[model samples]
Structure formats: C-alpha cells, structure tokens
Target: MSTLGWWRLIYAAFAGFLLFHGFSASENAPNYSFMHNATSAPFLSYYDYIVVGGGTAGCPLAATLSHLANVLLLERGGSPYGDPNITKLVNFGASLSDLSPWSPSQRFISTDGVINSRARVLGGGSCLNAGFYTRASPEYIRQAGWDGRLVNQSYEWVEKLVAFEPHLGHWQSAVRNGLLEVGVVPFNGFTFDHINGTKVGGTIFDEQGNRHTAADLLEYANPRGLTVLLYATVQKILFRFRGRRSRPEAYGVIFRDGSGIEHRAYLKYGFKNEIIISAGALGSPQLLMLSGVGPVAHLKAHNIPVVLDQPLVGQGMCDNPMNAVFVPSPIPVEVSLIEVVGITHFGSYIEAASGETFSASVTTTSRNYGMFSPKIGQLSTVPPKQRTPEAIARAVEYLDNLDQAALQGGFILEKIMGPISTGHLELQTRNPDDNPSVTFNYFQHPLDLQRCVQGIQTIGKIVESESFSKFRYDYMSWPGLVNMTEHSPINLLPRHYNSSIPLETFCRDTVMTIWHYHGGCQVSRVVDPDYKVLGVEALRVIDGSTFNYSPGTNPQATVMMLGRYMGVKILRERLGN
Candidate 1:
C-alpha cells in the first residue's frame, strides 16, 4: 500500500476512536452517576454540609468541601454537559432566550419592563452567559476584604479548567484597535487581571468554540464524599432554635424533586456542619425570604413564619445596564465571543463579539418590536393621540427592516460597569417554582443615566473610528426610523443629551441587562465578611448575592474565585487544613 493510503487509514482509525470516546465520556461522565436525579432517588438522611443551588459558586464550594466532609450539592436544573445549545459559543443567545420550564435559563421581565433571564442550571450563569472571563478588579477584592493571596490562588484553580485564550478574528481585532483609538489606553495584552486598558483577556470558550463552565470544577471533587442532585428545587431552609434568645440555625433543607415529591436533607450534628446558599442574587434572596429570613412585615404579610427579620436579605440588588450598536458588515467575519475588552476610565466597559447573526429571539424583545409598545406612553414625544392604526402599521414595517439588519450581525456591547442605582428582589409567591419579582430600577438615578450616556457615546466613537471603517455600516435609530450611511456620531446622541429627562428616556428605552446581577445578600448587611448570614447560624450565602459591590467586569471569574476562597477558609477553620 502507498504511504498516503496508510496515513489515511491511520487517520480514519483515530477519528473513530475519538468519536467512540466522546460518546462514552458524555454518556458516562466520570462522575455522572454521582449526580442523582432527585425524582427517582431516596434522600440521604444527612450530610456534613448542604450547599443549595449548585451553580457557579456552589459547584466549586461543594467540591472543595467534599475533600474533607460529606457534601450535598442540590441544583434546580439539569447538567449542562450534553446540551449543544450550551456547549456551542454561537448558541449563547439561544440558551438565554429558551423559555421552556426545564431550560437552564429562567426568563423574566423586570418591573421596569426590561426582559432578562437568570441561570437555572447546575453551572448557573456560567452555562448561559457570553464566555468572557476576567478577574475581579483589585479594588473589588480589597472592598470585599477577601484574603488577597487566597483570591489570586483561587483564580488559578478556576482558570486551569474553564479559562482559555480566545483566538481573535478580524472583527474582534478591529474592535481592539478601535478601543485603543478612543483612549481606553495601555495595551495590557493577554492577562486575566482586570486592568484599565484595551487588552485581550481569558474566555471560557476555547478555539474550537466549546465552552467550559464552573461545573467542570467538579473534576476536583473527591467523588466518594460528594453527592450532586439535579432537578431538586430547594423550597426553604429548615431552621431550629435552641432557646428563646438563640439565633435560628439552618439544620436541613426542604426541597422538591423533579417528581414534585418533597424531601429533606439535614446537616450532621456539629457546629461546623453548615448549609450554604450559593443560589445567585435573585434565587438567594428569594430562598431566604421563603425560609422566613427577610423583613418582618413582608414575611408576615405572606403568612410565612419569620425566622429572622433581616431587612437587607432582599435589598440592594444591582445589574449592569447594557447598550449596543449592531454594525452590519459588508463582509463575513469569523464567529467569536468576547476577546478584547476596553476598560474605560468613566466607570463603564466596552467589549465586542463577532458572529453571523444576532439571536432572533433577542431582536423580538428590542424596542423595534412591539414588546415595548405598552411602555411607549412613558416616552416624552410619543403622545397618546399618536396610537393610530396607520402609525402602528408603519412601526411594524420599520421593525421588520431592523430585524433583517440585525440578522446580518456585527455586534458590539457597551456595558455600564458601576452604577449607583440599586434595586431589590421579593417573592411573588411562596412556591419555589415561581420566579421572584425582580426590579433593576435602571436609570432611576441621575448618575446611572449619565454613565449609560457615556457608554453609548464611547460605542459611537469606536464604531466611527478608522478601525471600524472596513465594516462600512449604517446607523439604525429607534423612534425616528432614521438610517444614515455617512455615520454621523452626532445622530446617535439624543436631541437633548444635557437634559436629564431626554437622556433618561433614551436610557430607559434602550438599556437592557447584561445579566451580571449581584448584591441581594450584601456583605455587611445580609451576609458577613466570612459569607455567613448575619442573623443565622450554620448558613452562608456564597454566590454573587454576597457581592458587596458589583465588580468592574464579567463576574463569573470573581464568583468562582470567591467559591474557592470560601471553601478553603471553611476547610482551614473546620479541618485545620
């Protein structure tokens, strides 16, 4: 046989081996059986530690704790390993827009009328979000009072598994240059540390477009000591009080499985045996309130038994408001997630992604669509009398054109990193299955509006720069339905940028969440510096909800870092590690 023929035969065998191994690995994920489907199984009597909401923080924290103690990690959603919609980078939007009850993302519309979703999967937001990865700013670490050395070490632990250096495509490269041109200065190159500059950073998506989430951290778990139950919705924390003046202690969790059969899992008898609530910002507070740990009046109104009247349990919720400019490229650009970021001095951040088309479902929620028609009354110029049938028909036609343009997709995102405005979360119903009422209260503060305006202006500058000229795009306006080919940055601004009302209107109409919600269970107010609930014993809220303030970047890295740090701290305190 010829050498070439022999090489082909070898290649074929190698491909076959890979195909078989890939199928087997997924079918029997090394620790797959360790993950119990709560519907079919009998609950264990107890564990040394029970971590609620097996998400970004919970997965790692549970894994680490299992190194020394028997740990139970309960998740409301299924594993993300086998889902193509989650593993593929291009399907990032599809994962978030999926409204199915079993979908990893639970979609909700805020009181302010912005559509958003929170992660319902074991990996949590890491499974649903854009794959950008950056370490928390040093200032954030200092403010959180985290051990700096431990925090740095934790970054390494997460990065070893989920982090990757993105292979920037043409459009992403252009974006980097454009950010530099706009004075987001000092090219810091590839580094995970959050620095103020135009620089390439880590990503959760690899060169092959596969995503690695925090769930992968389970590889570090001592499988013998860890039990992960999926499709188990924690209804409330089971609390006990020893004396009249003693603080309520969380001893067990009441959760309903996929079969809707309720079960209880308790902690072993010891002071170190704890229940950690690693549910994200929304879920943590909702769980706390349901468990009767919120404001006294609010709990009483719902007829819930008050365990602790911690007023701050559901307060201080904040999310980064995002705005974007969709530039339709004349040429095809390689698909990419966030590669280069522009850390601006104005308390905002700029990041860009290149892909074939924007998610169709996302376009359906934009202002161009009729989803926001009810809120049109809030607009200053759109009078009530203007709600004519003819006007509606014209608006629909304009939206159709805008959707078509969006499908052509060159996407860039401008996010307000730090906003002063805060919101809150509250239970709409006592049921664990029901989503809580989330109010971002975006643009409620004067500074938030100004910051969003600055972000928009920065986006305009980047797109107008020489770096983006190769794309050759047209501007699409909201109300006026104006399309300009000359690319006038002035046209992008509102008619009255200096005026508070007009700017606020523009912001309200355009602003949407980047889904970096944090701070419901705040550090000093809800949970202490050690991450334990302020008024409770043996219970800690260890997710983004415990963030003292929003970090100045995508928060997955920070959440994972904190998870490891907390895990290590617990180990040292309890096991003398």
Candidate 2:
C-alpha cells in the first residue's frame, strides 16, 4: 500500500519545482532572462505564443512555433520524474487490460464525460502509446473537411519529421505476413505498419533504446527555442472582458505551477493575435466550459461564467471503441511470455531521427482491405442519415465475420465486452481537480454499436475460417453471442449467467473501446471551421478536441497535424513577416 507521506512527497516535489522554475516576476525569479531586471509590467512569464497541455498537440506546436516566436509550454504533470509508468510504452496482453500499475500517476481519466483513459504524467499519452504510425491518407485528409492547404501542409510537415526505418528483426511467426498476403492488412496494395516500408511483422519500436515521446518530437523539431515547463497546468485563459458589444479578446493564459503558485503567460500582445487551444478534446472544452465558454445553460448550472454561448462546445464528441484480441503464440517462443507481451504491442514506436515514432503499426495501409479500406462496395456505406434495414442486416453479417477472426488470432484476452461510449465527462464539482462524472455511453450510438459488432464478428469469422482451424480455441465471449465464462467471473462472489441476452444487445455488450478518444472541441460542426470557439476572439482550439468525430483510428497523429496547422495559422496571421 502506498503511504500518505508518499503522496505528500509527490505533491511537495511538484510544488517546489514550480516555485523554482515557474514565473515569479521578481529578481529571484527563475526566468533566466529576467534575473537582472525582474520588476517589469509584463510580469515574470510572458511569451509570443503560450501553449497549454504539453502532450501530443501542445508539445509539437510549441516546438514549431518557437522557431519564429517565443513559446512557453505549460503542463499539469511533473517533469522528467523518470517514472517508468509514464516513460515506457507497454500495451500488450496484460498491460493493455490492466490499468492500475501502468497509469498510477494519472490525475485525470475521462477527458470529459466521454473518454476513459489516463495519461497525466510528464510525457502524457505519447509516452505510452503503441507508436503505431499512421501517415494521413490524402483521401482521409481531404475527408476531414479541410481545404487541400491543411492536408498538403500536414503531409509535408509530417514527412519532414517522420523518419521511418525498416525493423530488421526476425518474425516469430508469419501471422502478419500471412494476413498481409491474403489482403486483410493491405488497403491499396501495400502495408503502412512497417517503418522500413516492407510487409514485415512486429516492427520493433524501441530499437532497444530509450522511448520517443511527443516531447521528443517537439524538442527534436526546434531544440533551440523550446522550453518545456513540466508540472505547470493552465488554470484559465486570460481575457480582457470588453463588454457585450465587442468580442472578448484573449490576453494570454493563467497557469498554476506544480506547488500551486499562480502566474500568467501572455501571447504576443496585440488585439489581433489569437489564443490557440490544443489541450486535447477533453481538456480544451473543459477549460472552455470552466471559463464560461460552453452552453450558457450548462455553464450557469455549474456557476461558471458564460464567456461564450457555444452550445456545441462539448457536444458531438466521439472516439473509436477499440477492441483488442491478444493472441497466444506457440511458434517457437523465443522471448519469455512477459517479454513477448511487452513487445509486439500496438503502435509501439522508438525515435530514430525525428520522423514518426519508433516501431509503428501497419496502419491505414494499402494492404488493409477491411472496413478501413477506401473501397465502398465492401462496406455498409450508407451515410449517418440512412440506417436502412438492409444496411443493418448487412452490418450484422459483417459483424459475424469480424468477431471470429479476432478470437482465432490466439488472443490472450479474458474480458471481450462491456465497453460502451456511454462514458462522458461531466462536471463533478466546481473544483477543477475533481474527477469529472464519466459515462461510457457505450452502445449509445446505433452506428457505433454496429461497428463494434462488426469488429467482433470479423475477428470471429477469421477464427472460424481455415486460416486458424489448426489453432483450436474455446468459444469464450459474452453469453448470448458466443459462449459462457469458463473460469470464475472477473472479481466476483456469486456471478449470474447472462444467457437470455438479445443478440443485438449481446453484441452491444461485447463492444469495448480501442482507447482512442477524440472530438470534443469539434471542428466546423462544433467550433468554427477555423477552429475558433464560436463568439470568442483570439481563442482557437486545435487538438483532438477539434476532431469532428473520432476518425476511426488513433487520433494522436491527426491531432498533431491539427496543432501544426493551427500554429501555422497563428503564425501567418500576426508574425507572418
């Protein structure tokens, strides 16, 4: 058991760090440049561009913008504490299933009432994401509703940072190869999982070295101008309330250092400059709401001042409900089970030379011929408006095929259901530190529920086929759709059998998250197309929160692109010279 003193130590250490490294606006302050002349009207900390939430989007934008402007990055978590929990990327088998040990330092889990994830430590999610690399497809990029400018810019930008190298490690089995050869992994005709650009299995991400994080990418991009201030959390966006007639312009940001000392960091002073918010979908909207920037009704209920009347600030949020199938491989087990599980996880990356992360996933490739493929004929392509009976029927058939294959792949999983998008981030209290009321709201969306069923069905289909006939496995899933729990129920005394559950609900119950949360400060639909919070000036959101909806895959890469694009927009507007 962890002691209360331990928590005190962690808390104290964080506080001390802020007093020393954060702004003081005094001669004794730690703003290296201001030590000689600290008494200034501008205060202890100021910047041309101040980025909050130094995670995936924040770090990159801060780093990029620093090249042309002064950047100050504020994070809520302590820096370089060297906690292995937040440093190493491990999400295979048991690691992925269990959360207690991995995300122990996490302060926030559900971003809003929507996501069910935790990565508040120094490196944030980038420290632990299975560095699956996904280069934006031109088609998918365009589909994001951005003009060609953003997509082309992102591709050009990513290509500069994404330095992919082939992982020459020997494969334990030909599962990935066999799947790729069979057109299951390929989208167009090639695979995108390989960092080395080949049809290989288990692209080793770490490359037997230190892990690469989003912080790494930012630092790598502009090592000179970047100053990462960890343990500093942005409390509010400073606004000069200019009454009802004119738009309230953003002055800068108010943040709390680790020790809980408050300070302000200004964006380059001008009435025209903007305050870019890239603090993930959850954080961005939550901050917006706290600052009286969401639905007037909701803000009033929380006693939060309504800075803006954006009703959709937190609405229209969605994330991909990821389902994982852990396969038990017996093909000459070279590494120990612990080692094997530690490796081979999803999207694991090792930083080589700045491009994408380390070992990446074979994602969005020409080889992936499944639903992610660009092909329309093979999918239930009906738009959100049309959920025709025929479409539902076809989806059910597809579901049957997807679930079986997942099981046959030698999955080392026990729980295969219960993940619902019903989870949402609601204000638990007036306190910012208080955990939000979370509801998965899983099986909430008819179409999303259908997709979950299809994923399970497709995996099952693969298991039933001759592709996995030799690997005999039990039909162990939820009660109605598959089989009964062979062993004891997970942490139970007297478990009841859910035998009569309907197939649809059973399939719904079988759905779980892939842990990809996105779409909070939604774009075009939620915020303005330029990502500005409607009715607010000098304030824009550019992060996973800006996603229109969960893009059906890992959102980090996309969010990074958004941060870059938004930074570029901010740069071009004021400092375009």
Candidate 3:
C-alpha cells in the first residue's frame, strides 16, 4: 500500500478505538416494555389520550400524562436505539445525511431555496441535533404566560434525566474565550439559564459521548399506562360534527403501520379524553391539513374534504436564520458539537462546533443537504437531493479533493433571535411522508437583515480575538484555504464570496437554517392559551408548532419542558386538584 494509505489506515484504527470507548454501553434508562413497533403490536380501539409524534415534546408529554390515564404515543419513525448515527455524538451529522426512507431525519428544501431537514425518529430533532440544552429565558416564559414555578420544576425534571453539564474540549474552550474577548459580556460560566452573556450550556451528550435524548424521558412514565407505538404514520384525524351549526370535534385518528396495515385509535367515552397532535411544526400543520383542516381553497385543491375551513392552519412559520464563519485550524481540533454559547444583547446567539465530517455520498441526493461543510460554492448551488444529476456531481466534486487534515476545522456561527422575518407552510402533496412546501423568507424583514449584519460583525470580532488566533491560519500554502487575517473585521464571507458582494447580499445568498423553526399553529391564532385548537374541541397541539417564537439558544430544552409541564397541568385538572 502507498504511504498515504498506511497513515489513513492507522488513523482510522485509532479513531475507531477512541470512539468505541467514548461511546460505551446502551443508553441508561429503565427497562420498560411500553415501546413497541406498530407493525407487530396488538391494536387497541381506545385510549384516554393519544399523543402523536414521540419527539422532544411528545415523549415527556406521554410519560407525564400516563401517570393518571392510559396514553397512547404514536411515532411515525422507529425507535432511536442502537443506531450509531443517532445515539453517538461523534457521528452527529451522519444521520441528517441519511436519505433512506427510514432515516431519522427527513430532508426538505424550502421554496425560498434554503435546504433543511425534519426529524423522523421517536426523539425528533433531539436525536438528530447537536444536543445543546438551555432553558427558555425568563422573559420568554413571562411572555408565554406560563406559571413560573411549574416551568422551573419541569425543566429540572428533564435536566435530571437527560441533560448533562458538557465537558468542554480544546476547541470549545477556545471558542468560549474568544467570545468573552469580543465583549459578549461577563462570563456566566456553566449554567443552563439563557441570560445575555458567555456561558457553557448543558448538553444531552453524557461523558461517554452517548446521546440521552427526550426518548429517554420515557423511563419516568407509568409503565402500565403508556403504550409507545413506533413506525406508526398517522394519516389523518377522524373528526365528527355533533350538529350542523356546532364546531367540528376530533374523536380519533387513522394511521398506517410500517407494513402498510391501517389502524384506528379513538378517545374513550368522556369529554376529558382527548387527541393531541405533538407532531412538529411542519408535521402538526401538515397532518391537520391532510385531515380536512386548513385554508379552504388549499384543502379543496388537494381534494381533502374540509372538516373546518380554518384559514390560519398552516400560516405564520418562522425559522432562525444562521450565518457562519468556518475557521480552518492550523492544528488538529477535537471533535465537538454545541457546548459553549454567547447570548448577545443584539438578539442573536453565538455558538461553535468542531471536527464534524460530512459524507460526500449523502450529498449525492438533493434530499440530503450537507451541513456547514467545506467548499461552500459547490454546495450552495446544488439543487435538492435528487432534483438534478449534474448538480449532484458538482456537490461531490466540491469536497472530492480535500484530505482529512483539511476537514479539521471549527465553525463560529451566529443565529438571529425572534428573526422578525416570517413565512408560511403549504402542502406540496397530500402524502404525510412527503415534505410540505415551506418558505422561510429569510431576511425579508428590514430588522431581521439588520440583526444579521450585527451578528455577523460580532462573529468577525470573535474571529479576530487574541484567544482564537492560535486556532486559525494567518497564511496557507495550499490554494483555497481560508486566510483568517485577510477576512478579518466582518469575516462573514464563506468560500463563495470575494470582496465584491455586499454583506447584505451575502447574508441573503448564503443564508442557512439553524434548524429552529416554529409556528403554523401559533398561540391565539390557531390555538388558545390552553393550547386547545380554537373553534374545535378535544384537540390540542402541544409541540413546537404552537410556539410563536423559538425558545432559548436552542429549543430542545424548552420543548421537552413543555411536554412535562402540560402533562402535569392536564393530570392536575383531570384529578380536579
């Protein structure tokens, strides 16, 4: 074998050993049989409450609700067990690029030309994301009108079981120092609160690099009361109208198992028994529309009979716009995901990750857009996973020449909070598995653009900080390597930009999603303060879909907390406490 081949072989062997040791044993949790595959499980006709989508919100919600009543949790995807791509933190980006029908993430492209993915596993995006965990800001809690004491208790419950204090690696520590050097504010040190300052946040990855997702919260469930069915694709909500002038009521749901078998689950005989849609932002709205609820014209176009002509079913969608600076290191950087964060007063959160490798083969299909990968010029223009063949080749060639050393880098990214810019979601096809057409009109609002500019400038300052100097290259002998000095003082430029493009234009063209998208069943618009769907009965969306704004630095913690919080509230009300 060649000399390069020998080095590659040795490196691979050593890396495998480290990874195996760092990611030991099955996930720690109660040995419960509540989880079952929908394909083989015996059918039940009635459940006190049916929670759809066993994700970040759905898992905790089902677990909490099961304490007092029989709860059936149906997830469209299989359980997130034993899959290295989903369970191991070292393989963070691999699952997102998996284009198989059963992959944990379902890739989609917005009509506005931005690429993104939706979670398909039991744990939802919590299984596919970088695992940063932070509580919602106190201000956010007050704005949402939540009981402060209950919110704190819920967050504590989730943190005890799943969230962990991350052990910062070399790359992460450096990033934190750089953030402080740039005047992000007084260091809050290690804390889960989302205050405006530099702090080391909590992570779902334990010390061994094993991911403890929201699915693990199932251990808290009343084993006899909760039944978890995986690979159960809910087709539509079965609705019935009591009288001609009465409001439509959700009674049951129709779903398909993995083997193409159909089944129906109904609410037990009681006004309190309910059907809850905890499916995510896209899934919840899409499911509602498919079940004959949404704008009348759109439903008519798809030939779905209108159960309710609610015009705002799939409107008011928002995504946090992310812009990043890839800093290629002069030395080896340890692999890490989001650990340290900088909450700025400018309404943007700064975060960093290192040593994440992208699978070139995964990028062959348009459905799988590679994450903040090297060589931006080739990837930014590539169409959706399978949209074009030539583009696929370009995507491949984009990273074909880079060696292992060149891939060793860290990304300093900034994502605007609130993102004032908003868009809407629409059904592309009636199939629930098909991705709904979404348009997150990024930077459409003037204030959003201004925030982007301010965030980008902050990132530039961090890049130029003395602490970050040791990690970056002042000059590179190789062509196309990022010269940190040349791009200083607004280093928002990716590989595609030179000196000609305006910063605002770069913000628009190079715009990407931080994977935080919410709304479409916003509070006071589609659902009431109690999260019950307005103009409907016994139906509620207790997921990110109901949120008007994304919470915290990342929304996973808040979503998980909401699940637990609502579960307690429902149980208390049911028991008349």
Candidate 4:
C-alpha cells in the first residue's frame, strides 16, 4: 500500500486514539466524603496502613489497600478538584509556572543544573504532567518479576476508570507521520502497550480535555476504610528499637497540618499492617533520610537520630535528559500535550507537543535555585502576584525579549531512554517540605551521551521529513509572516546547540529533565522485590523511587499500576491466597 494511503487506513482504524468509549464529565470528580483537612479533623490514632504522600502511586495504593484495610493518606498539598490550571488541557503547563505555596506543582532544580517539578497536590505529578499514559514494555514486566496476569489486571483496573484514548489533531498527526518517515518504523497505531514503533498512547485526559488523575481512582476505594488528609506533611517515620537483635520497626508517622500543628498517626497492631511511603522520587528518598533510614554518616551530620543506617536509601538517582527542536508554525496550531510517541529500537524515545504557553521565572524551591534561572535575576518567594519591583522588572524585561514566533511554534523533543548516568540525593535541611539536594549527572555515562546524540539525529530526520514541512516555520521571513508553502528548515535552539558545537557537548550543556527520574530507594538495594524496605519491618517504599529503570515512555502509568498491583498482592497475602 502507498504510504499516504496506508496512514489514512491506520487513522481510520484507530480513530485518532480517542479509542475507548467511556463515561463523560462526571468522572472528573469523585465524591470523597472521607477526605478532610489535617487541621480541622479530630485527632486520629491508627490505620491498618499509613500511606504517606498522597501522590500518583500513593493514591491508587491507598485506594486499593482501603478495599479491606483502613488507610490513612497524608498529602502535603491541596486538592486538585478546583484547580483549573491542572484539570484543563488548555492550561496544561500553567500549573508548573505557579510558585505560590498553594500551587499544585512544586518546581525543583537538580544540582546538575537541570530544572524539574514535583507534584504538590493530591494527584501528584499526574496533576502537573502532560497526561500521557502508556504501559511498561513486556520486558520491563518480566524483569521486575511481576505476575503477568496480575500486572495486566492492575493496569486495566486503573485504566477502566482513568485512562482514555487521546484525540489526534494536525500537529500530532504530522508528528506520527514524521516518526514513520524517519524510520522509527512499524505504525503500531493506537495502543497502550509499550512497543518499538510509532503509536498513539492512552491519556489521563478524556474527550472534554479534563484530566483524570490517579486521585480519581479513589472512587474505587471503600470510603469508610480510607481517610485522606490534605495539606499534611509527614515530618518523620517514628521507629522503635524492639530489641538489640531486631531492626528498627516503622510504627507510625509524625506529620504537621497546614496550621503547623503536629499530629501523629500510627499503624494498627498487625504483622501485615504497614507504613508505606508513596512520595515521588525526591520525596521518598528525602523522607527516608529525614527519618534516619539513609546513610549513617550523612544522617549524623544532620544531627538526625539514626534508625536503620541503610546506605542505599538515597543513592542511584537518575533522570531522563530531554532536548528539543522548536518548529515555528506559520498558522495557529492546536494546543496539545503528549498524545503520540515514537519508541525507537535504541535507548531513546521521541515525542512532541504544540502550542505550549512558555513562561520564564526563577523557581525558588531549592538552594540551587539559580541553576534553572533564565537570567531573570533574583525573585522573591512571595509569588508573582506580590512580587517586588525589581523582580517584576526583571520578569517583564525577560518576557519582552521573547521572540513572538517561538510562542507560536511547537517542540519536537527527544529524551534519552533509561539514562545510565546516576546520581544521589542528600538532605539540605531537616525540613520535610524543603527541596532535597539532588544531582542527576545527565550524560555522565558515554553510552547515555551516545544515545542522546542518536536521539537528536532522529529528531533532525523528523524535522527534515516532508510530513513536517506543513508546519515548519519560514525562518527567512519576519515573525507572523511565515508562508506555509515556503518554509525554512527547523533547527535546534541556537543558544542551546548548533553546527559549531559538538553534539556531545550540546547533550551536556542543553540537558534538561523529562522528569522520568527514578531510583534512590531502588529494588534489590533498599527495597526487596515485594517493595518492602530491607532491614525494616512493616515499612515499604512504593513509588518511583523504588524503580531501577523508568518504565515505558512515561513512568506514571507503571507507577500507578504498581500501586494497584502491590495493594492487590498485599491483600492476597493477608488472605493467604
């Protein structure tokens, strides 16, 4: 079949990835009658399971565990229900720009000089991410020693309520074709299965452009068994030295509410009852270190009482390095998140997004805050609405200098798959809400750098494809005057990389994070295969921090599934199934 004709057939068959016929607007908010303010609630005592950090993995884990066990979920941030910036697709990237204490997204910069964000809301990163949903490759499932049947069932359990097929538009379609044109081969079309091909994956967003986060999966929970406390930050995991021969046991967590009033929640007296840390990559590790479960010397330096003295707690950190080529479009393009992807044979993946609202500001969540700065000078932590004059002037000047054409364009990005270069996290302070000091050491490994070079070249091929010409900007012409028929070749950002700079150097200098970071409390190192923290009883790390390698194009799907899968496994073990 002819290429164009074949693509038409593929599109017709897939219907542009809005593939599932599911429920409508009502699914956006699930009535959580059991949810309460950490401060307003009466003092709580114990739960069958105490799940810390009500995030992507934490939500599903808590919800599933609540089927038969009483679960207490503590989240440091507010709810995502009324946050339009998080729920609406048109306002997708806006949440990350908000630096206020109440913002759903908390921006963090790695000591490696890469800017990143952590989810502060109940839904976690899902509330701040591009909302793409794709399962881990089958190889990933096998390597993790996951029960295939249960794994598939767990993915479906989450998907049935949350995941949806995405609607493909002109830009996404062009990207789909461009991926095939560049020999990323085999038009697998619309699928949630992770495979080596160009395909449209699932999204958490439904047809109405409203995101369905892991928080929505709480609808499956038994409300009577689940108590979710919003705006509660867990200060530390309280441990007991049972005897000289026994390891320290995690019995409960000490958390502070929004009013800064301390509260204690403990685990029920049962062998199966546990305290699970579902904090993201950063949070999980930081929580562990703060609770005196990390490296002994480091914890001692911080004057924290040693609990486990586990050296691997904050080690093996990694973040996928992302680079992009912004293709300026002549006409108005539809705004979209990550809807289509090209999974290549090599250790890399290609994805694209159009019409993202780009903003510049210094995210002040870390001591290394100036690293991610776009030279806007110093800004106050008071947020934009109440910014000082000097800060306001700096932001205004930066915005005024932005090229109008750049805002009208789309970005075709490539991120190195499963970056081999690893770094470590250290506690900057004992404060639970403070950002942890981390370094991803992007492209530190020669193989990772080579993969990045290959990925960028693949993107270059996509840019040079005939399919992308329809949207390529006419660089020769002035801004807003680009003629669609006569366009210039799209290139990487000049300030980032060019013909003069070597690709390896470009990979190092322009490296940014796709936020697929994992490890720290890695499996086989800190946690067992069952995700239980080694040397510590009744305590586990169930989030992205436990991952050795990030699964699929986005780790969110696997992370969510892990929550459900592990919860089910724990329940079965309780039943002796």
Q: Please list the residue runs of candidate 2 whose C-alpha ends up more than 4 Å from where it truly belongs after superposition.
A: 1-43, 89-115, 147-174, 177-204, 220-224, 325-424, 465-484, 488-503
lDDT of candidate 1 over 277-376, digit per residue (tens): 9989888999999999999998998999999899988888887887655566666676676788998888778887665433333313443211122222
Instruction: Please give the lDDT score at residue 302 for candidate 2.
Output: 84
lDDT of 2 by residue, 1-577 (tens): 1463355346646545544555332232123221111111133666666667777777667767777766666666544333332333321221222223223234333332221444554445555454544444455567776666765576456435532333422221233333333334432222332222123222213554334455544643454555566555577787776775888777787765534566677766654455677666567777877777777887899888767787766665554543333332223222211011111112211111110111122221112222111111112123222333454445434434442323222231111222234334556566454455544454565655555444444444434445444442343432322321222111110112234643345443333334456665666755787777677777777777665444313455665666677667766765644
What lDDT would each prediction earn against the true structure? 0.74, 0.46, 0.79, 0.78
Ranking by lDDT: 3, 4, 1, 2
Please say which candidate is ahead in lDDT: 1 or 2: 1
Candidate 4, residues 112-193, lDDT tens digits: the string is: 6565788888889888788899999999999999999999999999999889999899988999999999899899988999
What are the runs in model 1 whose C-alpha is more than 4 Å off? 1-31, 357-406, 474-504
Comparing 2 and 3 on lDDT, the stronger one: 3
TM-score of 2: 0.68
- In model 4, pairs of residues that clash are none
What's the number of clashes in each of the models? 0, 83, 5, 0
Best by TM-score: 3
Model 4 root mean square deviation, Cα atoms: 11.1
> To one decimal, what is the Cα RMSD in angstroms of model 2 from the true structure?
12.1
TM-score of each: 0.85, 0.68, 0.89, 0.86
Runs of candidate 3 with Cα error greater than 4 angstroms are: 1-30, 42-44, 356-371, 374-378, 381-393, 475-499
Model 1 scores a C-alpha lDDT of: 0.74
Model 2 residue 95 CA deviation in Å: 9.1
